[model samples]
Target: MSQFDAQILVAAFELSYNDWTLGLRKSNMQVDVLLQNEVLRRGSSILEQTASSLSILPAENADIEGSNLSLRYDDGALLILGEMSYFDLEGLFVDTDSFYLTTGYRFGQWLPHITYARLNSTDDDIRRAPRIETIKNNLPAGSADQIAVATVQSLAPILWNQESTSYAIGVNYFFSPQVVGKLEAKMVTDRNGTISQFQNANTSGASAPVIPDDNRILIYGLSVDVVF
Candidate 1:
């Protein structure tokens, strides 16, 4: 899911994936040895307002219910340049049909790289709300005991399919001799999907897909790589 167009005409070429585990180096300059290190990051989850309405019952402070269910994913990626640098300011463009690849060297101290990853969450459990009813029947005269019957007035309806898009961006630090840290940010578009489902209260034939709310959420984290 990646491509490398190394422009060694200007500098060395070095890249890493999954925190320096998967490394690829192609440089015009000769290197004494390929340096490698672990890169880590830490982040937090920003709950959106609409995330609560997704459930049938009222969402408590995560105390009454389990963790606010999330069907999306976001992570950080790091790369060590100088070990691998493309051409000059000519720039490079690589496309993955879903996302794009970009990098930059600025301020003499920071080398920023950015990329996009597609996300799809269609596995949400939005079952229809159930219906319940209580029935009471009169007994025959005083000699008989009271009779009561409980039955289902009607079954609850089901919520139609829900889809989402998880567009993301990531930046990593590739300082000389060491990779400092990494950061990533992702946003899910409101009701953003190619095809979606719907539900109606009519309980008639098939219902249309239900609509989701609008909310902005942010999730970030930090971590460290311990090498003994």
Candidate 2:
């Protein structure tokens, strides 16, 4: 299909007094895809291959809209931040929402922080598509076309959707004005059988990927940074 166009608007505000500072920001975005005719044609072709008498028709233009809001506050010794974001893809039949929060405290030359984040996605629109509905209703239960459609519908959400939560704790040490040492540990847990962002481990020697039974993982990291 044709390319998409996007428009965005943003606003931000900040205040600082003595050693305390606070900031807020908001943004909105819209994306439009020029694929109505192409989509209908392809959808109709798929139905024809399945020997369905139904034909797909053009619908509303494909579009996605999203918004984000965030806030941050910091004093000489304490820091806090939070953000939320959401997106609705009208044509693709997908919606996503996410949240994040972090807090940290500084003591002399050291700072320790903890963070939490969550992401969720759904494809209710895809399940409600005319082409998919036709296939589900018209095709035989064991037919190839029916099986293919069912497989795709079952795997799409697992491969492209997300429902996960993450928690992390980290500490930073200022070795000097221009150098720092950092250590961090993080844990991620998959939710609702979604694995869109996780790395799947393979043990079967087969080329195909396999999901891990344990959906939770812990990661450790250490680093040193020097700025000149």
lDDT of 2: 0.65
Candidate 1: tens digits of C-alpha lDDT, residues 129-165: 1211111133243221211111101111222233433
Q: Per-candidate TM vs. native?
A: 0.26, 0.64
TM-score of 1: 0.26
lDDT of 2 at 188: 80
Top-TM-score candidate index: 2
Query: 3-87, model 2: which lDDT tens digit per residue?
Result: 4566777777777776555566666555543434443345434544553323221122334556676777777689888888887
How far residue 28's Cα lies from its native spot in candidate 2, in Å, is: 5.4
By summed lDDT, the worst window of 10 consecutive residues in model 1 runs over 37-46
Taken over the whole model, the C-alpha lDDT of each candidate is 0.28, 0.65
Which stretches of model 2 miss by more than 4 angstroms?
1-62, 91-94, 122-133, 136-151, 175-180, 199-209, 224-228
Winning candidate number (lDDT): 2
